[model samples]
Target: SKLFGHLSSNSSPLFIMPTGRTLTRTEFVKRLREVISSFGINSPLYSGHSLRIGAASTAAKAGLPIYLIKILGRWSSEAYRRYISVSSSTISNAFVLMSKI
Candidate 1:
């Protein structure tokens, strides 16, 4: 179906299956939870959705251009704007760089 079609074309091995079984949302969440648990991180804030948010946040923090991040995350400009919150340190670092230039 639609999900299988999407997965078939996905480039990430994380999204593929040699068995041809599509990973459902529930399965994905369960796997995420298992991974987190294996890492011994008991933080309740970590979840499947957090993975997506964290990736986008990391990309933003790493100075990846907003336009590039928007496309990589498959988010609209508005949606990406809402999700990416630049940390105070990021702003401070920018200021320091400007001072040295």
Candidate 2:
């Protein structure tokens, strides 16, 4: 099984520092900024919230029900609607697929 996969070799907690301590929110944000900046995205708009938005949008694009996406995102309110961004092309493709069905 995947339990013995090389990626799972580290027994430490999934989110930890080199010293095996859980990362502070500040440190996590700093590291996230660094990684995003390294990719030549100098915009400060990309934060942890971006990850949530991306997940919800990706789930939506994959044809997952909105209710399921809400649950997967652990969203408590309709605010989740603001997180999922569906592009025009995605909607067009969905319409074409549904027409075939």
Candidate 3:
């Protein structure tokens, strides 16, 4: 299937698995925790929501507009605004750019 210029096999799962079974919430979290621990990250507070928020923050930092981020994140409401984590440097850069206008 073609989606926004990305091609995906219809029969393949987004997250490939040898078992060809979908991952349950618990299983996904367990795998996520394992990966985090392997990377020496001690925080156990990371969850699926963390990934969503991180995506939003990262997109914002990359200079993507909020609307585009919302679309990319599949956010249906304005609540995605809360997910953006703007840095001081980004704010200063924005101001610098606006000053040139």
Candidate 4:
């Protein structure tokens, strides 16, 4: 799986120093900024978490089953339900049934 593959490739040592040091959040952000700059994206709209939200939102819009999305995102069922809940407009449209009086 992509997650497993990423984890395998991103291994780090327990003690991160000059010889075996882990990157701090600031360093990670700097590296991300450098990559974005390299792409010449002056105003990138998306960040790392954007990708996660995008995936969940896309799946919801596409009408995929919520359980499948939960598995894909590794979210708890309640969290997944909250994540994919539809807007008022969508729910109203879906259930707007009228019969002749």
lDDT of the structure predicted as candidate 2? 0.76
Model 4, span 1-101: residue lDDT tens: 86644434554432255856676755655666778788888625545555467778888988878776766666655665554546788777677753322
Q: Residue-wise lDDT of candidate 2 within 8-91, one digit each (tens)?
A: 344443467778789876777788999988999984777778888898889888888977777666676889889888799988
Ranking by TM-score: 3, 1, 2, 4
Candidate number that wins on TM-score, 1 or 3: 3
User: Which of candidates 2 and 4 reaches a greater TM-score?
Assistant: 2
When summed lDDT is taken over every stretch of 10 residues in candidate 1, the lowest stretch is 4-13
User: What TM-score does each of the candidates earn?
Assistant: 0.69, 0.67, 0.74, 0.46
lDDT of 1 at 52: 70
Off by over 4 Å in 4: 1-45, 85-89, 97-101
lDDT, candidate 4, at 15? 27
Displacement of residue 78 (Cα, Å) in model 1 is 1.6
Q: Is candidate 1 or candidate 4 better by TM-score?
A: 1
- Candidate 1, residue 11: the lDDT equals 47
The per-residue C-alpha lDDT of model 2 at residue 5 equals 44
Q: What digit string (tens of lDDT, one per residue) describes model 1 on residues 15-101?
A: 545787777777777787788888888745566668778878888888888776766676655676666778898889889999998
Can you give the lDDT of residue 56 in candidate 3? 89
Q: Taking the tens digit of each residue's C-alpha lDDT, what string does model 3 give over 1-101?
A: 25623422243334546888877777787889889989899748887788889988898888888778877777779988898887898789889999999
Return the lDDT, model 1, position 99: 100
Error (Å) of candidate 3 at residue 44 is 1.2
